[model samples]
Target: MTALVLSLAAVGVILAFLGWIFPAGSVREIVVGSVMVACLFANAILLLAGDGVVGWREAWWNVLLLVSAVLAVAGGGPLTTSVLALVDRGNTRAQSTQKAGEVLRGGALIGCLERAAIFASVVAGWPEGLAIVLAIKGLARYPELRSPDQPASVTPQAVAERFIIGTFTSVLWSVACAGLLLSR
Candidate 1:
């Protein structure tokens, strides 16, 4: 069971890298998101079953920890992108894309770092770190989000929506990945 969980996590990490390396598209996003969802489900089942009892000192256990954390950080980008795409489906795609791009520059990097910090904090048993991470992110983004210098096509509401949705998606994915390590 432990081996299976670790293998799934490793595959998830690889798929996430592929998603990142390739141009952003529906197919890549779907594949990566599906694999990540599979990994999260597998981890949940393992936790529920309570079968794997590997100690922290074991190499395999450590490998699982490392892989899961990497997956947490890497997988979030695709997952969040997919979700934002879905939310944007109802709007004028080109305009929304432009607004989002203009309002949330460097969001992908910020999201990756956010996921890493969230995962590390959760795994380290410091839940307060989640608040700190979010607070810092919010503060840093406040200027742009408050008054985006976008065209008339872009609204402040749209920017705020994107920020909220992306942050929630990334944070949830990271926490779920961290749960895999906590299962042990």
Candidate 2:
């Protein structure tokens, strides 16, 4: 059962990477995101249900931790993109067409690092680290979020929405992945 859980997580991470590589809002992205979500949920269920004893050696536990962490970080981008698409479904074509990168530059890299930090913090029994991570991210991005020199096509509201949505999604995903491991 432990092996099954790890395999599911690894597959999800691979699908997530594919989704991240694909164009945002594309059919391939959606399909991959859906499958990744399924894998995550299934893994969570198995973990929570206590399918069997996970009496493994230290090395196996470490491998499980590594897989969970990778899934937490890699899965965040596709999950956040799916969420943003759902939230912005009612927007005009022009508004929707504006790439997220234009408004929140370097978000992808930041999100990956953020998810990794959050996952590690939670799994390592340092939940307070979440607050520190968010604080640092907010402070680092404050100038860009407030700058009036942004492209005309990108509104302040749009930037703010993207920031909030992306952060919440990324954080929640990491926490959930960590929770799966801790539940065992």
Candidate 3:
């Protein structure tokens, strides 16, 4: 039963990511929202009725954690970007398009790794290390962020706002997942 539940959760994560990536109007939103609710509901059920998974060797629960972490890492970019885009709805198309390079320049891949690291590190009882991770990521992006050569069309303030919103969403999601896992 636990195995079956965890398997379903894994599938849910995949569907969620697919929905986010291939959003086709309201259908995509409905699918993603439904999956999100279902995942949370299923997780709640597992926590309430399933056997406790107190150790790494607990097969079903370990799989659940693995799936959750994958979702955090993989779905995080799309989720964060979507949220940020909505928040910055006032941004002109040109301004948003101008910042596209920031996203494409390894940001997607880096975000995945960052979420994974945050989830894994916190689960491993080293949550403090997340500060270092944030520092490194900030330092790595600082050069491009404030570069004098940055196109005049892209304001540093806009870029900074985007970065803050995106990073906060990513980190917060990872931390929330890790916290949930820890509770389990």
RMSD, every candidate, angstroms: 2.0, 2.0, 3.6
Global lDDT of each candidate = 0.80, 0.82, 0.68
Error of 2 at 6 (Å): 1.8
Checking candidate 3 for backbone clashes, the offending pairs are none
Better of 2 and 3 by lDDT: 2
Instruction: Select the stronger candidate by TM-score from 2 and 3.
Output: 2
Q: Is 1 or 2 the stronger prediction by lDDT?
A: 2
Runs off by more than 4 Å, candidate 3: 1-8, 23-34, 41-57, 94-104
Q: Per-residue lDDT tens digits of candidate 3, residues 35-74?
A: 6546755765665565545543567667778787877776
Once superposed on the true structure, which residue ranges of model 1 sit more than 4 Å away at CA?
52-57, 93-98
State the weakest 10-residue window (summed lDDT) of model 3. 24-33
Cα lDDT of model 1 by residue, 84-120, tens digit: 7677776874446435766689988999999999999
lDDT: worst 10-residue window of model 1: 93-102
- Best of the two (1, 3) by TM-score: 1
